[model samples]
Target: MARQETQCVIHHSKLTSYCNVCGEFVCNLCKQSKYGKHEGHHYMTVTEKTNELKEEISEYQKMITDKSLKPLRENIHEHYLVKSRLDSNCDELTSEVEKREKHFIKEIQRASQKLKNIINGHRLEFSPGLASRIAQLEDKKREIDSLMKTCENVINTGNTYEILEFSKTKKSDLNTTHSSPRQVPKLELHTPRSGSLVGDSFGNIRKSRAIFTDEIKVLKSWSYDMYIENMFTRNDCVWISKTGFFVSVKPKTAEEVERKLCPVHPSGFIVTTSGEIIYSVSNEHCIYKITPALTVRLKHSYPYLPCGLCLAINGGFYVTMHKHGADGKIVHYFNEECADWLEIMCYRKGVSLLKKPIKIVENGNRDLWVVDAASESVIAMNSAGKFKFEYTGSRTCFEPIGICTDSRYNVLISDFGHKMIDILLQDGRFLTSIKLQPLGISRPMGLCVTKDGHLCVGQGNGCVHVLRY
Candidate 1:
């Protein structure tokens, strides 16, 4: 066996420096030597290199721990634990309710028994006398009573025994009638106020929604070449059907109208306010436009790749660019005269430009919403390219894939986690979450609000789910 060399072979000395240029450890003599391989190379002290490596290790550890494991599984496990505890607590509450119910039943039985006893005592005191009076009234009770008293008085003069018997019956009847009127039997029960119960038990549980049904009515389905990419609902449903483009005019009543082959393979598209559609093709710098008159023409040929676009409410249109190796920017084009796109918003503010923008939409405020996939955030900017705000999931961690807004300025974002759609306010406040997994909708990509107040959620692979908003 041969012993391994621990020292640098060239300098015959222990390692002292790390050559950053050559990516190797070297001795102090070799690192500074003019005749060695690492001569004149940028080098760091061994301790410095060790510290740098440690920092890198720390960064990688933090990435895996925080991003991969903690955010991914920790939230799930935490919810599962909470669900378990909630179930246990529910059972305990149910047991407590049963115990209370038994107590209430026993109390009610006792109250009912007391009422029954009072009624029975009333009956014992009144029935016999009432029945005898009714029987005698048929024979004229006033006259009979007078006659009986006279006969009793006459018999008492002759025989005192008959008078004693009549007196005994009369005494009993007088005692019963003269007694204090039986206490009226009345029922009372305690009830809690409805409005105050919610205030006490559930904190901030103000919004209440009644779900009519959980059944997913699978209204329509259409198959395309590859998969459904981007879609928008104007008066009609315009979508990229994998291989080409297609439109469903009356989607609620029909399936699809016709299929058109755009040989360039479109990436994303949007319907303009003037009944015209503008689309972008993959690896193509040209923006194509199609009119309702079925005319196809090239709108503009930019030097950079046009990715996604949205027609603005302010007579202009917003377009996002995807450069080869740089951050993308949204440009507002207002070419009212010809195919020449007049630039309106290209002033990029520092740290405000989108990294890699995908889809674009304009809100009621005429502000542009840019979905930047690289940054994992929906960037909102004013018409003048001023940064408005960034929504990157603060209430719950989610990947924003598709986004849409309703008439009430409610923003709905398709979350890639748990197959859900997150609802947000126009000013970026969390409202609610709509889970679509029950409907078997997965990888929700394209979202649009229809004209008749229905939400069309595109499930990537040529499948669309329609929901009544």
Candidate 2:
């Protein structure tokens, strides 16, 4: 069977050649036509073009294998190796924990039994004799009491003769002396020296320290015309909340791919694990969640104005809020269903936990890091709402606004006043600082740690800087 040639729609002619300049298959008439679109374009036979493309594809295959696939495969293999080692180390730790648990249980049981035996010995040695002595003393006391009462009644009601007779009869009994008071023996059991779960006596777990350097590498930067108040990364893209809307932009191309306008500007926003945007408007009393399809829904209504938002490790979230014209800034924890579960109000002695919390983030260890701009510090608390530590910058003019935590659980705070990102250990110890001024990152406010460990910083000057930490 013979193959039919392709016909050109414009001229109804058989297509026999390809135009390199126009990048289209052309008929002989197309090139020969004086007034045609491809009149002066270079032409080549279809077979020749096919052969050229085959050669180019062969080169591309080699380039891909050497430059891309090979390196990716090696990296994947390294990840698997690391994962295997991690699993083995975790198993050993678990076994060690179990062994320690068994040893502690046995020791506790032995100590309890010893104390019980001492108590039983004390009871056997002193109980019966003490009971008998008490009974005999009680009988003697009753006899003396009755005699005195009879003597008093005769003196009060009878005549002098009755009083004298009563006195003479009671004199011998009254002269009898009682035994001196004796101290009772007491059984004192000392509590055994106990160890704490978090104390060094029991053992402790330490996190892997994040390796850092003073060199700040800016992997990508995007500039916008609108002011970026808050931004969070979702995969390769980031959703930035501007004045009255949220825009999703690709940092690589600096392209605004999607935009959703809001009635009010958000005080803070966060991208959840499920690709939902949870934000709070400071003037409003409710938190809102925007689904992936940009459908907005009310998440929760609270008594105070909600602001900073963060997702918890247990599929919950934290929202920092405060009453209008009030100083008692508090935080609320909500479940995955957006139902309020816990409210952190004050510390010991009714001390305020946060003065002006502008942002919040949860680290890998479930510690909540809140940026208290009014306090000029980053307050940290455990997952159970116990205050951990407050990290006020070592500098005098510290003004922290944005906060996020890295994989190592180290808290990262963007200091707008210092124009730098301060890194601290989970215990609130200042580890280091990344000066963003040198890298052209001014007024760094909103922060999000990308999945690949890059730090996405949204600055006040309409710039988003992605740093490789």
Candidate 3:
């Protein structure tokens, strides 16, 4: 090991000068020695060389401040402004809701008071009439008692004629009858029907309309000679598959870190949650798994040619395959142990489910998404193999090649024919399209979402485009 202080190995002296020709430090003895390597080489004093290098370093510092630091500072300021405006908007919305709530409460109280007044007026109008009717009935009962006393006195005189005379006199009184008592007024209350508060009477929050675009800004890109068939992202590195090779490249410098040779199918491969590389060979009808240590071994063999593969979040995996010589195609789900679990072939008795299922992926909801090239559509099915929906692009010539799902379960499909990527919901509804032609990406094929939520797109022109979508 060498010390921090530079020393000349041959001269056994402290280095004090810089050798320009050899680009190394040298001592005074080494420079002036007759048998020295720097005898004829250009040399300068240590102090002079330090001053000259300081000037160059000053220029580098200026470049860094102007080109990198300036933009970063501006971005920070812009973000601060955005955050301030967002906070202000939130406060304003809350104040508006509070005002509306106050108004609603006032209106309810006013309506209740008005209804109470009407009920009180009805009670006041009926009370007097009811009392007067009771008084008249009591007076009539006293008159009947007086007549009965006069009749009893005549009967006590032991005269049948007097009794008959009393009956005749009371005949008119007996026929008389008090009118029927007035019924208490019925109070039938009416109120508004109960329902959701989001209506004309009560305000509601409206969803912000999405601003669609046909272009996606490219963050960075790397050029290559071989066609990149697929991309799998793990952490900061991206693994791409070409004809007969699987290469892992660091995005920072676009430098190749590792390469493995495998003539994988165009649908390429997938990296499991456990960091295992799973790929398929169409001609051999086989699937291979590679560990993180670069050990490759045969994992499974299929009855038909296996094309595309994907892993589920629940420890299962899925694969799409085509019949050996028939037009029939199918998708198979394998359990956590890599054993066949379910086979999905036809949607019904006569209707087929898939035509040419190529790339496959499982979304956050456990729904399987398959890119069917022959049908020119992306197919979605539930975990139980039930058909969900098929999404054919708006364009007539929809040539979908790459398929991936984002953290939000938004399905992204790369179309080679239109040179665009379609963003869809997990339910197969199209949300928007990202045009790649404008970004100089002609053949957008392989797609993957990085761990940091960035999108990596592989093109047919042997270049991969990294986007911050």
Q: Whose TM-score is greatest here?
A: 3
Candidate 2 accuracy as TM-score = 0.53
Ranking, TM-score, top scorer first: 3, 2, 1
How much is 157 displaced in model 3, in angstroms? Answer: 99
Select the stronger candidate by TM-score from 2 and 3.
3
Model 2, C-alpha of 55: deviation from truth (Å):
31
lDDT of 3 by residue, 86-107 (tens): 9999999889778977876666
Taken over the whole model, the C-alpha lDDT of each candidate is 0.66, 0.72, 0.73
TM-score of each: 0.51, 0.53, 0.54
Worst 10 residues of 3 by lDDT: 203-212
What would the per-residue lDDT of candidate 2 be over residues 440-465, giving only the tens digit for each residue? 88798888777678788888878788
Worst 10 residues of 1 by lDDT: 201-210
- TM-score for predicted model 1 compared with the true structure: 0.51
In candidate 1, what are the lDDT values of residues 277-313, reduced to their tens digit? 6777647577777765664555554667777777766
Off by over 4 Å in 3: 1-215, 263-267, 292-303, 324-340, 346-350
